[model samples]
Target: MRPQYPFRVRHADVWRIALPACIAFITEPLAGLVDMTVIGRLGDASLLGGVVLGALVFNIILSLAYFLRIGTAGLTAQAIGARDPADGLLHAVRALLVGGLIGIGMIVLAVPLLMLSGWLLAPGDGVREALADYFYIRVWGAPFSLINFALLGWFYGRAEATTGMILQFIIHGINIAGSIVLVQGLGLGVEGAALGTVLGQIGASIIGLMLMLGHYGGLGQIVDRVRLGELFQRVALKRMFGLSRDLMIRSIALQATYAYFAAQGSRMGDIELAANAILLNLLFIIGFFMDGIAQAAEQLSGKALGANWQPAFEEAYRLSMIWGLIIAIVMGFGWYFFGPYIISLMTTRAPVQAYAVQFLGLAALCSLTFMPAFVFDGILVGTTQNVVMRNGMIASLVVFVGVAWLAQPLYGNTGLWLALHAWFIARGIIYWWALRRIRSRMFAQ
Candidate 1:
């Protein structure tokens, strides 16, 4: 076997992991497209508006729960690097337990959560009713979705991108197919769409469990006679929860920026709201592509740090940056040339199409501005640098608010896009500076 110490990281090394991760990430936006397409075809802008708003509410909630994925991935990656299968298994177990508890909490708090979101979003009357229906149905799947986060993070930490890719495919495939059946054939409307997603999560969780068991040589092998009490050790629990708390804060700050973006668009008008939703999906597509490279950073950097090899870590970071930038540029050009056609497929509304096209160029531009932040996020998260991540996101949110406050009144939607870009640019700068200052210190013996 080749030695990894001097880590001769190459583009191929990044792409090997990134390609499958990219496909998995792309499935997310594709599922969004399916939701919009099914609802948009119903030919009511209000219905479309409801799905958009309902999605944002979940996005915020899920962002809070996202600690399961990011924290588990970082911790498990380091465990894998150190060749500690037991530690990796334990990390996954802890994450799943915490995720399940959090999911149940969300269900218990569903009513108040919905009411709070409705008041904050302030959509039109027609949209409000539809959003309520979607929320009630979707909340039931919270546990499944949360547990899936843990499963996915564990796979990525193992650098098992293909497994992660397969898991995502199963979830999204079920979502798109079930949604079509329920919404189109059964005429369930937005409720059907919501139920489809819930069903997908439930199905995926079951399959994920079976896969994990089979891979680990069944239940007996998994537990391996370890005392149940060991899983709840105070030091381990504290470390896990501490990491979760920081990642949760970072996720909330990130989600707040997106929620604000959707909220402002809602206030504009239904057509504008619908248009912005389409563009937001496009932005997600771009973001996820870069996230593929970020996954590489997470696995490689975490692995390097786990092995206590600075050279490998540096090479991983360098390779990730190069590939991230390349993918961003490619995506920008792809959107610029083909965005109109894609927008046309999403909706039949002439005004929505025109408005979305008007801002398509700016959305494409985001691919580049957002690249640095994405790459840095993977590296930091993989290295378990949670403090920097939490602080950077909060600071970037402030920059976003300031930019949007000044830009929105002056340029309308254009200004809103600008503010979003400013947020990403700020994140890139802050993460870059922090990493530079701490790099040598982090690798110190």
Candidate 2:
């Protein structure tokens, strides 16, 4: 049987995936917002600073491991396009096993990881105690959190965005509720916030397992049908691992750029660091919307490739880019109008609020320059063009470093924002050129 929906990409088809994905994407940052808002209200910049530091470390770690989600999505989406359920299921399962093992490793090495992060980040003295408390408790959730990544990737590849959205809602909704109750109601501080997020991850992973079972009819049938020997097939594992390795390297480079941004901000002052963190979350909020459209590109492009339908592939790329640009424009204006109010709401500290307000424009402008990279990334991932993705990101990181080095010394934090935009622009251009060159070779045969 063929895949459902028209082969040609349509506006309605793109939104069918993008809308729900967009909603799902924002929920994550909203959860982060909830954490920031809860910690920020305490009137202690140090506590908020500590949470920021702890969160930054987790961000880098998760980013490094993000290949579990991305590689699985590309492989499963290809399997889906080929109408190979067995292969698709195998990809997801493999990713889950890998994610679980990585999570366990992270837990075992939690203390060392924390020590390394503290040394590299060199956070202010005021934030160290709270950061330690938050980091220690949060490491317990690593397994659940990583497993959830595989589950979400499975759904995305299947074009079951609604299911993915519902799962995200469950996880982030629980996070929001738990953080409020634990931190605000119980006054457990940064520890409460960390624990709240952990609870949400655990709850989602259990529910996701049930949903997986239901998808395949039942546990008994799946156990009988799935062979252990085939599950560890070398060819498939090598492909998955190779893709994951490149993606992992790509992710580290990307995260390192952002980490540098945070580290540099921290050096200026606690208030500057806190302000940048608030502003950074808003940037993430803008990014989530664009990323939602990117999800459309991932599924549609992969499906088209699997079917060997160039027309469908072209349509997917064109429509995805159009929608991404539209959303970027809207978000840019929206941020310009409402960013200050949102920043004020996130933090009551006068200095932090003022600083964030002053820099909001630079962040808003990011929507325009950064939108292309997000959309391009989806297509690259969907097509399983891992080498191109890896090379593009590394090149972009070089651009980021060069720009920052030249600009930061002269213009301060504003220069850092400019460097970030330069990176985004470089990525978009590199991907655009690479894809154009690849398309001829990919379909010419």
Candidate 3:
């Protein structure tokens, strides 16, 4: 019998990759959860407020480098599909080199970052000082974190989800343990939380790089030709910067939208912000789980595109949606059943808990369309449909801001929650159109 050159795409691929990757993604957020827990344990709302505010600032900076992982994933997946060994390795190298430069740049801007964070967050001196400490310690780890983004992105791009999963486990496991030790045992407070984060990211980056490098035989293969050339050869550099630039635009818009959410919450006061922090994390789980399907689609679609297997390319979406909905429904239950217990445990204030429950409840509703949006996002990334993706995100942001501004004056906190939930729905609708358009164009040929 002839060899079946096109192997079947299994649901197991998603579970195999996404389950650990999902757990890893979930646990990675635990670092923030840890910070909130430790700080909340202090019996100081101010501390809770400061940590949440500080962390938001930290993520905004980190989010800018998201392209390093996402763009790398698209390029790497293409290599995997083609069975071409060269592109994947070179892809990893490109990401790592870029990661190093970002690290240095982060350090140089550290002081200014603090100044800017203070200016933007506009907390009084006491909160500002604590936030500054958190910012400084976390900032020092920028190189490691950014590099990890690149490495992990490449790993996912190649559908080597298990490697990224294990790396995340090791990273978060150490970070969580370190956080409890420093914050509780040593009484390091806010700074301890920051220190734990840095150590965890640094340790994880080291391990992730080792595994990723060793995954494809060894680095010697990459070192031979790549070392001799102009590191930024025009054609290659153009692709890197071009993809990087577009992805960066997408990240900025997405991050800015979240920033808008946080900034709006800040104006409403701390309990509202804390409640939002809790609620957003619950909503965030939807994205994490959906990414499993989306990423699987991303890998499969890229492979299909490379092979020009129109049927498999088409099958990827149908396959992704079927799987995506299942994961979202499971997470939604996790939210509805257990979320209140978790949120109540996190905060001491009655109003905070009340708001949290309400917001989380609405998140459950918001996620009805979450899976589709995510699967579509992966499709876009896989297709290298950056411009459309960017446009979709921008449109979503406008809807979000417009709705929030219009609603908040009338509904107060409830209005904010409503706006938040509606934003996801709007995102789902707009991106669905974009993805469908791509599907049509791909097949129309």
As a TM-score, model 2 comes out at 0.90
Q: How much is the lDDT of residue 163 in candidate 2? A: 90
lDDT (Cα, tens digit) per residue for candidate 1, span 290-331: 889999999898888777778888999999998888889999
lDDT of 3 by residue, 1-445 (tens): 2111254566676566666667777776777788789888998776677788878887888888888888888878877776765657777788888988988898999999888888877897778777877887888888998898888888888888888888888778877888899999999998888888889889989888778656655677557646536455678778888878878887888788777888788899998898988788678866776767777888777766655556777677677888888777777888888988988786779999987887676667656656777888887787777777777788888888888989999988777777766767777788777766666564443
TM match of model 1 to true structure = 0.90
Tell me the tens digit of each residue's lDDT in model 2 across 322-375: 999889999899998898888888788999988888988888898999999999
Candidate 1 local lDDT, residue 77: 84
Each candidate's TM vs. the true structure? Answer: 0.90, 0.90, 0.88
In model 1, which regions exceed 4 Å deviation? 1-8, 39-51, 122-129, 187-189, 263-277, 344-359, 407-414
lDDT for predicted candidate 1 compared with the true structure: 0.89
Alpha carbon lDDT of each predicted model: 0.89, 0.88, 0.78
> 1 or 3: which has the higher lDDT?
1
Best by lDDT: 1
Query: How many clashing residue pairs appear in each of the predictions shown?
Result: 0, 0, 0
The order of the candidates by lDDT, greatest first, is 1, 2, 3
